[model samples]
Target: MKITCVGGGPAGLYFALLAKQRDPRRDIVVVERNRPDDTFGFGVVFSDATLDNLADADRPSYGAIRASLAHWDELHTHFGGRVLVSRGHGFSGLSRQRLLAILQDRARELGVVLRFEEEVSDPGEALATSDLVVAADGVNSRIRERLADRFEPRIDVRPNRFVWLGTTFPFDAFTFYFEESRHGLFRVHAYRYQPDRSTFIVECREDTFRRAGLDRAGEDETVAYFEELFADKLRGHRLLKNRSVWRSFPTVHNERWSAGNVVLLGDAAHTAHFSIGSGTKLALEDAIALVDCLGAHAGVPEALAAYEAERKPKVLALQRAAQVSLLWFENTERYMALHPLEFTFSLLTRSLRVTHEGLKARDPAFVREIDAHVASKAEAQSGVRVVSADAAPPPPMFTPFRLRSLVLENRVVVSPMCQYSAEDGRIDDWHLVHLGSRALGGAGLVITEMTDVSAAGRITPGCAGLYRQDHAAAWRRVVDFVHARSRARIGVQLAHAGRKGATKRMWEGMDRPLERGAWPLLSASAIPYLPESQVPRAMDRADMDQVTSDFVQAARRADEAGFDLIELHCAHGYLLSSFISPLTNRRTDEHGGPIENRMRYPLEVFDAVRAVWPADKPMSVRISATDWAPGGLTTDDLVALCGMLREHGADIIHVSAGQTDPSSKPEHGRLFQTPLSELVRLEAKVPTIAVGNIQSYADVNSIIAAGRADLCALARAHLYDPYWTRHAAAEQGFAMEWPDPYRSVERYTLRMR
Candidate 1:
């Protein structure tokens, strides 16, 4: 297969390298506008996972990139004097020039012909030269425009104007500094590119740009403005631009990505707003995928079909996120003027790729602690999730359930996880695999983990929440595909963990938050999960009522999200559970006391939730069934509690165990607490879904067979095998609908059947 990649940037070079690797005999040429040494941008950051993807596709190149990487483990967020440094953000800061040089060398070594300083304006040059022409000319790709009607380019000019500049200052970590200059809330994303210089990208919304008159300002003037914005941090290190050739990057997005023999790759296909620092990653990844598709498929049309089909969703998602980042930066005036904290959080979320649930894996402590914040308990960010028959499988676990109107099928669920890979709060390529494969696994129900109800509810500095219009739009592709591709039902689990926060990630040591118990935990009563955790503030009467309403309103929003079932997280030691657990509830008010009293606030939460939840659909409650501590709640307590929940319109009782008490020793084992689920099933007489360590086909079938529970949820196992459901069906000789794409794999006629 012969291939011609236009533009010598990361995408083209990487694609050329990948193509040659796929077929050494294949003639591949990379045409660039600049010399081998010449390149734009300062540095590009790639996470550990991105490296793994590269390694998976082309290990030699992966090893080469890794070998040359300037590694950084921690990401530092600057808020004036307060510096929040969190570890394990996992990015290697390699300069654009360095990245190109490496790819240039790798492509050359891999037998890729690099034709530098060759500006061919016509597609005929690509057509005449190679079997396939990749339209990777960048954001303003003329090849894509020539076949504009074929590609269907939906060019969305982003609002915020940003300049990608470099500096010689030693920036070892990714630093986001907010400046409330007369220019307004200008945020600078500065991170190390080389050992001496850092890539300083000055990003500001349209309002700030206009107010500062940056458009009219000369290149040096903009740099001066940014220097003033980071006055003390710069430490006299000068910021430099390639001003001899003027460039202020306008974030570009295209609706239609590929057409005919020519296909778009990288920034030419889609541009991720600079906030998330993944422009090059997207391009390189496209190159990798296109090559694999060419190798995998038999011919050009099929390869193109597969590549476009694969890359389109990915590019669109990234573009949507870029749009969000662009809009958020452009709308900074709105957030900065009214809600600074929210603005900052929104910025963090916009650059992120994965959903809120992913944070549990990436940085559990951050997610936990954020769930413990004030807005978290307010219930404004969580509510009932709606799912239509038209809705696709969310993540992997999706099922058409039936309880009044709520229906889902399948038991596997992609527990919500966050890919804080965003610069601001947008989804990107990382998000696609982070989500799509989970759906591909055939889980009946994949509920996105606890998505922050509001931007502020996001755990860590990086949990992605759906609190804005751009958020909804950004997620549409994710939700749409899960529904279209699989039988799985998709739903978003929204949560606000109140006051249980302030720490590094889970792997880092899910530590007790900053100020420990001093950050004022808000609950029905003044109770702390532990002395090291925050000492929760006793909720005043006003707080209680307001929180109840917040839950209601958030639920309404969840309905707008088009989720299928609404699961109010009254479990996992979050705020709702705080009110239910005796260990945390010390109040004598209507919201606390005996089981009945303890049930009040949570019930009020449920009732408020019920008022907004549809009368027809089934509502579910996930509870810590047993608090484990003797004086806390008992299994009997959960049964009664579940009975009450059923009375309040909850259809499924998702039974789990402990969290509130520090001394609670959970009896740990495989399906150790399944008996508790049995009790909840028989006693409560409501459909019960059992979770925790139920990891096999036998377990799922037996649990449902023995009537211990109506459904069995397999979480960790699903992660281990996304296609577990398919494997299970084949094991059981049950005919399941395998996706059309994989049907060929089913033909094993050598004697097995």
Candidate 2:
């Protein structure tokens, strides 16, 4: 089968190489609109992990990429009298021109044609000649546009404006500099593309552009703006400018990524924010996934379908993560004034796919010191537990933190995730095994996902509940077993769905409500989650009283079931969170407007739960932190909100951002949500849980060790490997035993042939 890859950039060339290498006579050709050595961006980055993927696919191309790489290991982040230098970032970047030269040369070696300066519209140029047309174009693709209805693409215009340009400032390594000027926060992403010249990508929020008259500035003026802002770093070298113009690339994430015989790859598929250096990696991974599916299946349609099914989920996950990261960065003004150090730390962690534990291993001592600072503020709050690293346990992240009366052995918590396998708020073996496995996997605490406080409060019918005595009895089975067997402490996330109620099962469609009928939903106002989501009933004073009582009753049932902790689901666009976020709450009553007024209902729910909950048992609140929607609750708002929670007795602030609105712009990347969590934990001086794309053990270790957040919640990673903590321990070359009952089995497996 002949495969024609349109738009010959890294994605197209790499896909051609992978496809041709997979089947030596498949006949793959890459079409390019630019000359062989001409390209758009200055320097593009690829990770060490990206190199490994290359080696696994095509050794020859891997060698070519390796030979051309600049091998940058160090990254220096600068801002506010603080210069943080980190290592093992593994960003091998070079001039885009040089990268294309390498790919073009290697393509020729492999008998693949590199058609340069040749443009094609849709499949008009290659359709008659080729069997498969792979659209590997950068952000904008004519082929994708023609088939836009099929792909159902969603192009998000990001709030920040950036310019991809080169400077001869000798920035010998990758650097992220946040400078404060008369124009506000200016962020520059600069890295060495060659021995002498560096690619300088300057970024500023749209507000700053208009405020500083930057949109009207020319090339020379832009350079001067960067120089003046980063005055401390842009010393003698004069910060030379290139001819590249300043513009913003809309971060594109599509609901559909592939069509019948055609598929989108790289930026044309999903665009990760520049804040995370995965743009090139994302393209290469798309190539890898396609090749794997092709090798596994025979027919073109079958392979493309399988590829889309598998690749779309993974890419969407990263794209979602990139959106969260981008949102955090674009909201700089809200955070800079509150927690600059935590802000910088959040940005640093968001750039990689490392786990919390994995980050701790990279720099344990540094992480420990940061944790110390958080403990120092115990006196700042009145009845809240002080999370001292040394006081908890010598293992740092492995130490169990206590809330109210309940004690969690470690900082890693299995974030409450939906199983969608329950029957009418009743859990089954799947829920038990899912929650139990993580408990056995070594999470200090495991919280069940949005266990509805009432039948009407469920986002979906499959959501677990604690409103009834039987439901409490059903959960007690899992809690009792976990308590009797695993060291993991069990916590429940009680919530009322409110405006988001009566949704279908997660697997069936996710957001759409049931077709047969609908349940009466209650909210602060009559507003709905979106235009499509069912419009909900506006809660009156009596409805509010009942909902608050429902939460209180749920807390009482949880106590009967022997739970160690109770975390209120006041985030993720649920009932409690709906009432708190301005983007959703539009009421004229006491539960509306100003931060204090909006938080009234949420705080009332907290008090009701706290009153019913045992004093010894710990209670926490999970907040979306940032709505990701513009003009929503900023971290500044969160700081004040957190202070209020502290006053009313919140032990830990469990933070997971976004889901504020479907249209909310999120700049997601690795650990993108951690920064906002870090700020609330640090500046507010409260124990906070960090989440969002926390996949690896290192990430878990680092956040705990760094004190960016006391607890790191793993959602998808735990799903992929229930025993991730155990596997990570072995992967990191540390020895730990499974529970005595499972020890024999673990040992046998470890020694098996």
The digit string of per-residue lDDT tens for model 2 on 545-568 reads 999889889999999988888999
Please list the residue runs of candidate 1 whose C-alpha ends up more than 4 Å from where it truly belongs after superposition.
243-256, 337-346, 351-357, 364-369, 375-753
Instruction: State the lDDT of candidate 1 residue by residue for 1-753, as single tens digits.
Output: 678888888888888887887779988888888788876677888878788888887777678778778888766766645565555567888877778887888888888888989887767767776678998888888787787777766655645566877888898888877777776776678888668878887766667678887868887887787777676888898888864223345555555555557778887777776766678778878887888888898878789889878877767666655655555455444443323332333344543343234433566454333333312212221222423244222211222345565445555455555455532334555655656677777766776656555543444444555565565555566777777887776666655566554444455445356533223346656656566665667777786776666666667766765666677778767777887888877777676677887888788778887887778756777888887877888656777889899888887888888866768987655565565676677667878878877766655543443345666676677667777777765664445677898887565433566
lDDT for each of the candidates?
0.67, 0.78
> Which candidate leads in lDDT?
2
Q: In model 1, which range of ten residues has the least summed lDDT? A: 374-383
- Highest TM-score model number: 2
Error of 2 at 254 (Å): 3.7
Taking all chains together, each candidate's TM-score versus the true structure is 0.50, 0.70
Off by over 4 Å in 2: 1-4, 16-30, 55-64, 108-115, 121-125, 238-243, 255-260, 285-299, 306-310, 332-345, 360-393, 398-619, 622-651, 655-700, 706-708, 712-753
lDDT of 1 at 484: 82
